[model samples]
Target: MMRANENARGRLSWKVAHRAIPFALLLLAAAALFHFSVEVGEGDTLAWDQAFLLSLRHADDVALPLGPAWITTAMVNFTSLGGVTVLLFITLTTIGLLLISRRPVEALFLCVALVGGWLSSNTLKLWAARPRPDVVTHLVAVGDASFPSGHAMVSAATYLALAIVACRFLRAPAQKAYVFVIAGSLIGTIGLSRIYLGVHYPTDVLFGWCAGSLWTFGSWLLFRRFLPSQA
Candidate 1:
């Protein structure tokens, strides 16, 4: 029994140790992406961006992305997850679920994280004032600056932040893994959908992911300290 307990404790310690490594890397990666976004916005990535965006298109028919019509249709649907309307729906639903579970303070923290990320994305868009992709015809219409894909940033912030909350509700390893996997898949696919539709450059989505992740995790660190009684 003592040996089994020690083995369980060792596994727990290992999980904690591995978790710390990624958190440290997240901070570093966020800084790196922000720096590169600044450089790209200033025209340093002109050749690379054009090359990358064009690669995703058919050579003979550059207007269309290099995929079947149905795939394009599916990508459009997936991309909507990052759109304002869809994101708002997700936000409201998550808040409702948290309140139902008697986690009001955590729900509030979730709201703050999401709102802050959205505002930051918009502010950065104005500051950068970068133009939308001209490499190919956009599968969907978009209006506004495109230095960072708002859809990418906002979805990543919301979904990933929700994963942190999910960890609290899910105790079993399989349940926790499933929750994180779904959340991560949504975050990744939403970002890719923007690039696939020719609405955002690859760099734009990349930076958005970085910024969103940094903000989400940072908020979690703050809110986790708010004990239930204090909350």
Candidate 2:
């Protein structure tokens, strides 16, 4: 009986590891594609998206005006509640989870996914170098290259990662579904806010979302394999 149990455990471990391999491969492939896209000047569709977003930013009656401030203000400040801050929070949270779970491998995987996503986003932005929308004045001034939206990319990675971690703790199918829904909604809201604030082009947001999603999903697959059955 003892030998049989050991064999069964080993088989489960192998199956998990096998499933993770594809995700790791996918991450590598995405990195390579990101590099290629950077070298080639094929992904520059930010102009129109920026224009549309700018229009929304300037609208005085787009949403309810609570005195003089709106949630959009928080979205506009990249350093405040924007991409950079959000990413930082996500990174810290992942670290905390690693510490609590005492799973160095899982923590490392999350770190790689986060950093990898950031690097990919920046590379595409610099390579594309699409100008921000000048048609409508920008709500907040930005000088960085504006191709693929950083906010979109970071939000996708952070939220998706959170969802993955949450899944490990939540056993009920309904609970897991709820967690994923919330994660997806947060990511989507952030991306749209970037567009609505006249900061990121629609295409930039779209690509960012796609790239981030791919990385997050890929990392999740790889991380799952390393986890014990209870984990």
Go through the candidates in order and give each one's C-alpha lDDT.
0.86, 0.70
Residue pairs that clash (backbone atoms under 3 angstroms), model 1? none
lDDT of 2 by residue, 9-83 (tens): 999999989876886778687877577446334544445554455456535643332234656576555323336
TM-score of 1: 0.85
What's each prediction's TM-score?
0.85, 0.72
In model 2, which regions exceed 4 Å deviation? Answer: 1-51, 54-71, 77-82
lDDT of 1 by residue, 1-231 (tens): 999999999999998887688678777877787789779878988788888889999898879788679999999899988887888887889999899988987788789878998999999999899999887898898999997889999998988888877788666889889898999899899999998888888889988888888888878766776745322
Worst 10 residues of 2 by lDDT: 58-67
Can you give the lDDT of residue 8 in candidate 2? 100
Which ten contiguous residues of candidate 1 have the minimum total lDDT?
222-231
Every model: Cα RMSD to truth? 5.8, 6.1
User: For residue 72, what is the lDDT in candidate 1?
Assistant: 92
Model 2, residue 183: distance off in Å is 1.1
